[model samples]
Target chain A: MESSRTILTKIFTDYYLGAAQAKKDGKPIAYVTAFTPVEILRAMDITCLYPESYAVVCSASGKAGDMIGSSGMGQFAGDLCSYSLISLGMDHAERLPYGGLPEPDFMVATNNQCGTTLLWFRLWSQRKNIPLFMIDYPTGSENTDQNEYVYRQYLALIEFVKKQTGRDLDQRVLAQQAANSRAACKLWSQVHVLNQAALQIDAAKLANALFPIVAARGTPAVCRYCETLIHEHSRENENAVIAAQPSFRLLWHGYPLWFLPKRYPSFNDDRFQIVLNDYTLWWDLDYPAADTLESLIRPYTSTYLNWLPQRRIDWTEQLVRDYAIDGVILHANRSCRRALAHVIPLRDHLLRQGIPSIILESDMANPDYYSPEKMNSQLESFKESILAA
Target chain B: MTAVDPILKNCRSMVLNPHHRRAYLQSVSARSCGIIGYFSNYIPAEIIAAAGFHPLRLIGCFGSVSGPALCDPMCSFVQDFYATQCSGLADLLTGLVFPNSCDSLKVLRQVWQTRPDGPQCWTLDHPVNTDGPALLYLTSQLRRLASELAAASRSTVSDEKLHAAITEYNTIRGLLRQCYAKVEARRLRYSDLLAVATAGLMLDRNEFTRMLQEFAGSSLSQPLSGNPVMLAGPLTDDLELVGALENHGACIVGDSVTNGWRYCSQDIATGGDIYTKIAQHILSQASPTAFDLHRPSLAARAAELGACGIIFLNQERCEPHVHSYVKCAAELEQQSIKTLLIEVEHGRPGLQARDLMRIESFMELL
Candidate 1:
């Protein structure tokens, strides 16, 4: 049987190659944010690509520095979101993975993840002279009006996709896509639940498992990949003897350091096991079963990032209890201000609850802002304090 | 040399000192129903006034606070606002209305709500598009804000009251435009024009209108004498940058900042549903960098203003303006216009020596 890592790599490689071919074949391709409702585009046969995921690939492949430098030459400030900087830099980048993403026919973005997405995508829309459709997600408490607004925008977005691609959305295909998304999400949630049972899964393996969920959520490939992940974890657990539980279980509370995936192993040792991260659990939503257009509104609007800080704090405390997490590692990503804005208050809230947490300041895609020596020293001190507690 | 008028002098003092502005707000709040603070221009000040509350635009303060940081990498404007709130402004205002405009302000709203004793807070969600559906959505948000304000102030917003507020604000906008005309004609200094506009945000509407009417009609001796340049970017309360620009031989003929022309360029129509008209006015104006993609060209505006160069004064760590500057600078360069980009830190007392040197060089190029 093929390992899950190989399966994921194959899935992603095929996806990117297919996108490139679609560009060559003159098919419609839209650059979309990760939080956009892509199933609607998929139903219309419009190929959707994620610049945010592409940026992560560049960072992991060690090409982000060059791309970021190119962006600086274009006058984009280094303080802007590194994901956006890398994506913008790709046009002038000397080296590109997959020969750079094909020029998008159009762009779709949602502000649910961050406000920077709107600005970043708008830059492309203006530069390319392509139509850009924006979906505004109201931050803070959810109301019926907010939900209704989002639902109507989804309807409008479907029309926009149709107009851009000259393809009609098939209701049947959309229903099937939603069902596939729900199944994959269920399986992904089960994987996290399994990790809670046994602290044996490595953090890097889980991070590797995030690609399919983020990239292929509305397709059957994601369901298959998630099933393989579940099977491999269970099979490995059954084959080995009872695993020794680590002394400390830590929860990663923000976006992963994509530039340093290899360093995740340093976290899984005799003293600590990274039980879970909020980034992987972002899509573990209870998608409605009806599979109607209206059904998607709640699931899309109710992502963890869209909630207010208080709600997020409550959710984090619940996760700590549920996973028996000993401490938290907050990634104060310099590139992402929206995510970083709530970190201080969240840290204070956790400390008041008798939970120890430490903030690691770095950029997810830009390694220039990250200091390994400083991060290591902070981690060492955090470990001693957790052990002392 | 001519002596400064008392009205302009008071406006200048208020702009230079936070204490003077706080005292002015206190005096105004004592006579009015209450003072309601708003963050962005997207917020309808008319609605707050119609609710019998004096609307004060909260241009954040300067300097650091002596507490744990609320957020890192936040624009100095928002940081200073949070610092001021932490200091005492939270208790001084009846309520705060935050437009869901930028990421930092949105998160700051949420963080403010986590405080049990924070002022009554409301968020006005803004739509990035200006189509019919967006207009309808924004109108709905305006109506929601009206209801929120009414409940807080215990006063209703009637159509008559709203129209009256609109007319008063429109008058203020007209008077400010006349003042800008003086700047264009080189009859008034641009720095003085900015101080008056900034003071207008904090003063009572009626008092500001009367003061501005007198200033606009008064004869001025000091004339602007330097190379004309248009200023564009986000909300900047840094008067020092303007002073430094003019000191280095640059005339600020016009601006596209939210606190300047963008705030008062258009008047809300009084014929239609008041909320819808307010929505249309906001959506019609040149959008702030964070709000819309299809913004009116700053280069075109600079050309119209007869300025040879543009000074893009962006607050440090402000993502929207930084991203917009790249595109705007490119467009301006294509048009054979000179441009200078200055990233200013808000809490800092004055312009840095390097920034001053850059301004000087940019002026020389013009």
Candidate 2:
């Protein structure tokens, strides 16, 4: 693992400098949340900024948690709640890479987890005196309401664009960006889909490529970057079924790429291939850039982990059949309770549907909470259960 | 006390009929009769009577059978209350009054505030000591809570009536303290004291005092072991947790928990002094409730009340208690008072295996 200083330096050099350069060059750089509809932002020619992204940068740099803890923000160790503390302490945790914490014209509060997070953002907006545009979800509604709520949040996307950048939410731009996002998602999905053939790319290439998907989803550069990979793969006929894509191609949920990066290779054993993860997929698929906001974002595709959670569960169902996987390693994440709670009923349902499911408890960040030995033991026994099934 | 007391009878029936507890709550909500919630037995009786609502002491989940859940068992109990609230069982709680003694109650107040139906809640920021800003805070919060309760219950927080409630609660506190002494000295089993405590539910303060006197007679069938096990954690009048620990090789010797011990001697004064004792006692009780002196240094508390071992039952997710756990453990160990730390998120769930293991290990060392 890279040290905190190294990660901070890299984030500073790449995304922050790039965003600053883009802003100076008269190309608009609108920042949205991780939970915000990137297609909507892309349509407005706005760049995305996940507040949580800055939060992670602060936490990894070892400032966010400490400052938050010391600043009477909260007792992370006391509550054993890393999520609340990290978020409450995001601002003072570290220096802004792009200088002054991405003075985006507006901020968004997504109600995916506990509504307290929304409250946290509200207090933040009050403190910062920023217009905190809300991304409302249908409170406690499982799937259908969530999508409608996400769609409602999309309406604010246009309003925020008009307010922030003094430009109308051009439907043409959204549709074009949606198309670009779809193309990128397709490429990204192909990259994951090719994992069925195992070790399709070198470890370094795969790790480096994973970044553009996570951090640069709606960017033209990312679309071009992924497009190159697709073209290159097509020319080479790469990803030949490497040892019949392990019998257990598990869909590892939670923010794996960030929280428990060490556990990344824990699934690398021959029999179990962690086929798709939620971290990067949170950004894939934008609408073809368009004039109308509705038409623009209409072409956007989403996973269950997306604002479209119906799609999340639906994707799992489809993957269960399509991938012919034997089990699901439901790495139940504590920070993302909105996502983790979904797994309880899903676990029961999957069991009835004859799919093996294992729920392992963990906090997303600060690997201290995750017991790798315990999780590995659980999976090993669960593998036996699958074989028995 | 009143001929048309729909609330008091409702609370009694709910306690008696635990299974129908959920249904009874719906009826309370149907009438828009607000619930009066108290965290512990230390609750002032006059306040419940004045509030004109059934006093509800929501107990922890009922058993320890579901131990296999990876998380702590108390969390299951807490989830039970949360689930019930979400399902609208306790929706009738128009207002809640609680002594600020534990973080669990603090979190519960937060949860109650956010429920679909707005339950006007007030923290009786009771002091851990009889002095300091806690006195001012508690008095002010209680006065504010009085008006809020009246609005919810469709009554007035008449000063005269409030004085009466304080007197009644003070009387119960006085009697409970005397009874607690007997219980502490092994003169009586805690069950006798519990009977007197429960009698506070139906009987008025003076009447309840007489009943307790009658109950705490020189001779009782059950025996009280002199071995004082100081019952800790946010307590309830429903000594289920205490009794369970007793059943599992422990006894109720002494307690730091306010539900029983802290509120025992409270004597709410009358007039401008109406909020006087309740506020004074509550604030004095707010110190991190372990061995009373920030753990490891509990000679003051232990010597004040003779105790052999300390049982620390922290309400799970109740951060303050959990923080004090290791420190309390080390401190009690220093005193050679083997401490049992039970992380109870909610009280209903029985002794978890992890807790049972902890207890066994502690007992073995002792």
Task: Please list the C-alpha lDDT of all candidates, in the order they appear.
Answer: 0.81, 0.53
CAPRI quality level assigned to candidate 2 from its DockQ score: incorrect
Per-residue lDDT tens digits for candidate 2, residues B34-114, read: 567665543454566676765666552322323223222123334555555555455555556654443334334444443
Tens digit per residue, CA lDDT, model 1, B1-366: 334478878887777677777788788889878888898888889999999898988873433445445556777777777877787644568889988877888778888888887788888888877777778888899988888898888889889998999999999998888888888878888888888898888888888898988888865567768899998888867887788888899988999888888877777788968889998888886554244422568877887789999898888777778767877877888889898999877666766889988987888888
lDDT of 1 by residue, A1-389 (tens): 76677788888987799898998899999999988888888888888899999999999999988988877435445568889889988878876987889888999998888888988888878877999999887775544477777877888888888787778989998999899988989988887886676775567667867888888888887888877677766746465333467778889888888888653426435778787887789988668999978778777787777888888889889999998999999888878777876788889888998899998888888888888888878888888879888
Tens-place lDDT digits, model 2, residues A1-389: 33323443464466777766766776566444454556566666665665566555555454544645643333225344454456555556555334534555556654433333444454455545666655543322222323443454466556766787777666666666555556667777776555444434332234445555556655565656665555444426564223334666666655553443343537536776666564445454444444344443233323333233334555676767765667877766555534643455457667878988888777655555568788778878887887788
Write down the worst ten-residue block by lDDT for model 1 chain B.
Answer: B286-295
Instruction: Tell me the lDDT of model 2 at A40.
Output: 67
Q: What is the TM-score of chain B alone in each candidate?
A: 0.95, 0.72
lDDT: which candidate is best?
Answer: 1
Query: For each predicted model, how many residue pairs clash, with residues at least 3 apart or on different chains?
Result: 0, 48
True contacts kept of 2: 0.03
